[model samples]
Target: MTTGNFPRCNCASGALLQGVELAPGLPALQCPACDGSVLKLDDYRSWQPAPAAVTQPPHVPEIEDRPSARSCPACGRLMQRHRVGSSPDFRVDHCAPCQLVWLDRGEWPALAQAGLAGRLAEILTERWQRRLQNDEIRQQREAALRGKHGDACLDELARIRTWLAEQPHRDELIALLRTGW
Candidate 1:
């Protein structure tokens, strides 16, 4: 139940985290002083059941971003921060090589409420990562486009693209528009 004597709570509790067995063969270090817990990703994944199709996604409350850095208790190294889901809030610290995750106070319960606790694998999927990258790229491109063409021209371009979709030579017109000729 100990990861090399026990991992101290990284949230400045200065208290030794208690190792708790969430499931058989699945152990997690919980902070006695706070709701924070350090979980082994492999254990959590094994404990999680297969994701079911959700008719409507649960609403996740927006948590404020804290300007604090956290380290992996196992390795004593700075952990990378990532949002739990599509929400811009609720960041979690992850040590990729160690496969360990640090959940802040209430973060785990929040994820459960949001119906994402069982689907932690989703964030680790290639498809999800690629989609995030694509979305960022698209945002950057749109910002650049707006800067270069202005809002009015961008609106006009949108209208033109809509109209071009109805035209026969859509591709040719689009190409010309792209070239600005």
Candidate 2:
């Protein structure tokens, strides 16, 4: 989007952003061409998500994910991307210094569908990022284990691990196993 008096879109779409209410009372600058939105964190903090009867994620074929780094519409600086969820995984572009968030087309709807609409602020925190990283790493490790050991062996190990957690002498049992027979 074009930039001058108005905020530009971070998507490099060359369209100037206009004011719009993404949700009731939640004001945001929206791009006409790309349908992307730029919203202030301050506005988001004061706004509430509309309650939905549906609890499942929307059937999104694919949400537009601009994998490349985007500039902040407000500050003209590169924004940092924060992972939101694993299913249909997408990242929200954030400018922490400017307190702004850039949501690509359909990103808001997807986030809301995934039950993460209310946790936008939480997604940008260090703890959340670390948790997301750990989760991805764990998934990778599991995939490797499954590849090498196969599903049956992994499933059995998981079952044993669960059973071992409830035993009174769990440490002793583990030690005996470590020592063989």
Query: Top model by lDDT, which number?
Result: 2
lDDT (C-alpha, whole model) for all candidates: 0.70, 0.81
Give each model a TM-score: 0.59, 0.82
Candidate 2 pairs with clashing backbones: 1-14, 1-15
Which residues of candidate 1, in runs, are more than 4 Å off?
1-4, 20-27, 50-65, 125-130, 136-181
Residue lDDT tens for model 1, 1-181:
4566445775656787887753345578988876577888878876744343222235434443445767778877888777665555577778888888877766665766666666666765567657776887887898899999899999898887789889999888878877978
Model 1 lDDT, residue 169, Cα: 90
In model 1, pairs of residues that clash are none
Q: Per-residue lDDT for 51-164 in model 2, tens only?
A: 751244445435787878888877788999998976534999999988989998888877777777788999999999889879989999999999999999999999999999
- Model 2 clashing-pair count: 2
**Candidate 1 lDDT:** 0.70
